[model samples]
Target chain A: MTHKIDIKNLNLYYDEFHALKSVNMVVGEKNIIALIGPSGCGKSTLLRTINRMNDLIEGVRITGEVFLDGNNIYDPGMDLYELRKRVGMVFQRPNPFAKSVSENVAFGLRVAQFKNKKKIAEIVERSLRAAGLWDELKDKLNRPALDLPLYQQQRLCIARLLAVEPEVILMDEPCSALDPIATMKIEEMMVELKRNYNIIIVTHNMQQAARVSDLCGYMLLGEMIEFNKTSEIFTNPRDKRTQDYITGRFG
Target chain B: MMKLFSEKSIKKALTVIAFSAIAALLLIVVFIILEGLPFIFKVGISDFLFSSEWEPQMGRFGIFPMIIGSLVVTLGSMIVGIPLALSGAIFLSEFVPRWAMRIIKPTIELLAGIPSVVYGFIGVMVLAPLIRDYLGGPGLSILAASIILGIMILPTILSISIDSLKAVPQSYREGAFALGATHWQTIHMAVLPAAKSGIIAGIILGLGRAIGETMAVIMVTGNAVILPKSPLYSVRTLTANIALEMGYATGMHRQSLFATGVILLIIIMVLNYTATIAIRRRVGKK
Candidate 1:
């Protein structure tokens, strides 16, 4: 299977605090992968590495290569905006822009200077439809995005990412703020999304990983302890720590 | 029983203290209206407002020129100040490093603490001469006053705007960046729009400060009681008129000054009301 993303010996430090140790992993195209671990286990940190969001932080030092479609993203000449355009992210909380629903979905295209209003509207409608928000939000496109319910807002954020036509969607605990029903809705969308895009999610819920992801990687103390098929990781983790964490032992 | 008694008494005392401020404000408003309205009625409303004649000794009481002067100067100051103050705010809030901003922000705020008289002095000695040499007309003209008032209101506008910009959620910025927005695009699209109402509030406050400014305006506006033809023309604002004439005036002249105060009060209240409505509209949309 062709790899969508290749991380080679990735190490990240935030001002002498080692966040991600020497780590390597490859993500296949068109699958849902879940990274599960306790808090501060570098799961979210590793997820941010793909689009270089860590560069926004002060005093962050990274030494490794993250390649998307066989091109090293860490190269000095790489266009950061281009990299992020291809690799979109959804945050832990629903963070739609302080704008109308249509404008929120059209944010990416507007930034890219897409001047054709009709085409932009079409993409906005299509993206909202893909995220299953079109039927509910179509009439309320002019309403402020913050006024929406949490689940709808999260789906709106997903639609925002879809507007940019990203190949890889990085979700850092996208359903952490959501109730079980909302969480299930987001998980169902994730499952549906994997057919067209490589979806990498960092989540704390082990059961969510089991239910939605084809592949799962258990992380411990900035290291990838074990990664395999989700069923294998759940039923028979190769590492003792992974098994301990899976079976309700110490995190 | 002793603790409960003391608590009730303390609450009563605090309420009185808060009410005292309101009482003082109400008293002042009533006093200004009582003193000013009779004189306005005596002068006839249209002649008082529309006629440009302002000579007190001749009993000519028209304040049309001063009204125009105040609006023109305030408008000029806004033109000069808003862009500079807003850009400074955006730079401090978004682009500058924290350590650098810490130093720079306080230094700009220090501009506010410097006495307005000092700003006027600088205007007289430096800015006026430069304008006269290069831009023509009297050195102390509407243009000169506007520039000084612009600099004076900079800190007020800048600090409030920075606070508003900083108040924008970090998540909005992250959301924009996660979609491939450049730094400028994120700020322009997400942060600025979210902060619009607060920034507008800052500008309104600065407008109030500019309109009510007495000392620097009196010093540099040349105190000419006429409708200004250009920014280079010397003009007298309403505040300047009151300050320039309040001393040794009696009878109707004294009431006219009070009327000026009433007008100034009305302008400020209108500005504040507009700002509240603007901010409320934004909140209502949300």
Candidate 2:
């Protein structure tokens, strides 16, 4: 299978604190890959590195490579705008823009320079439907996005990402802020979304990693301890650390 | 044992204190009116508001020219000061690093602390001559007063605007960036819109400072009791008129200076009320 993203010896630092330590991973095309680890294990940091969202933070320095498709995204000549357009991100918290629900969905497409009113409306409807949010929100398109319930807001954020038509979607604990029902809905949406796009998700729920992801990568202390198919990783694993973590021996 | 004290007595005492503070402010307004009413009645309200001629020695006390001068100079200051202050605020809040913000924010605060007299002296020695040479005429014109006032209130606008910009939540910026908007685009569309009312309040506060300023303006405004035809024209503002004439005048003339004070107070009150309304409206919208 062709890889959608490849990380080679990627290291990240926030000033003196080493966050991600020489992390190497690959995400296959049109498949769901989940990074599971303890808190502060650098799962979110690694996820942000794919879209270069960490570039917004001051005193952050990254070494080595994160490639989207065949191109090194860290290259000096790479266009950040174009790179960001192709690789969309959803944060742990649902952060819908302080705009109307429809506008929030249409924001990414607008940024990509789609100015035609009709085209934007169609994309907004399609994206919302794809994220399974259209049935509830179709009537309240003009209401502020903040007015929606927390679960709907999370799905709206997903719709926002989908609207831009990105090839790779990086979700950093997308369901962490959600209740079990909302979490299940997002997990289901992820499985459905994978038919059209590659997905990399960092999640704390081991069973969720097993249920939703095609491949599971277990990380610890800023290092990837195991990478294998979800079934094998759960049923049989190579690393003792991965086995210990998966079996709930110790984080 | 503490609950033995009657709640009514405590409530009455607190109410008295609060009412006393408000009463004190109202007393100043009353005093201004009392002092100025004699002159205003003698000069006639229409003549004071509309007449151009102002001669204390000949007993002609028309305030139209001074009022016009104040409006012109304040408007000029708003034009020069608002954009610079807003941009300074944006730079401090969004662009500058934490270490740089530490240095720059205090420097702007220090600018606010400098005495108005020092600003007056600076305007007289430096800006007056520069204006005279560049724009011609006695140099100490409405333009000179405006430029000085602009510099004086810049710190007020910058500090307030920076605070407003900083008050915007980080989620707004994150949301915009997640949508693939550039930093500048995020700031322009989200951060700036979020902080618009606060920025407007800052501008209004700057205008209040510009309007009420006396010493710095008097030093550079040529002290001419004439309607300002242009920025280059030497003219006297209402505040300057009161300050310049108060020391020597007695009776009605002195009272008229106090009347000018009342007018100045009214204008400031209006500006402050507008700012309050703007802030409330923004809050309501959110």
Best of the candidates, lDDT: 1
User: Model 1: per-residue lDDT, tens digit, B85-171?
Assistant: 999999999999889988998999899999999989998899889999999988899999999999999999999899889888889
Cα misplacement distance, residue A32 of candidate 1 (Å): 0.4
lDDT string, candidate 2, A146-238, tens digits: 778889999999999899998998898988899999999999999999999989999999989999999999989889888889999999999
Count clashing residue pairs per candidate: 0, 0
Looking at model 2, residue A194 earns an lDDT score of 94
Clashing pairs for model 2 are none
What shift in Å separates residue A165 of candidate 2 from its native position after superposition?
Answer: 1.6
lDDT of 1: 0.92
List, residue by residue over B195-248, the lDDT tens digit for candidate 2.
Answer: 888889888989999999988888888988876667888998999888888889
Worst 10 residues of 2 chain A by lDDT: A1-10
As a whole number from 0 to 100, the lDDT of residue A157 in candidate 2 is 90
Per-prediction DockQ, in order? Answer: 0.73, 0.40
Worst window of 10 by summed lDDT in candidate 1 chain B = B277-286
Q: Which residue ranges in model 2 land beyond 4 Å of their true spot?
A: A98-103, A132-149, A235-238, B2-19, B33-48, B51-62, B248-255, B281-286
Best by the TM-score measure: 1
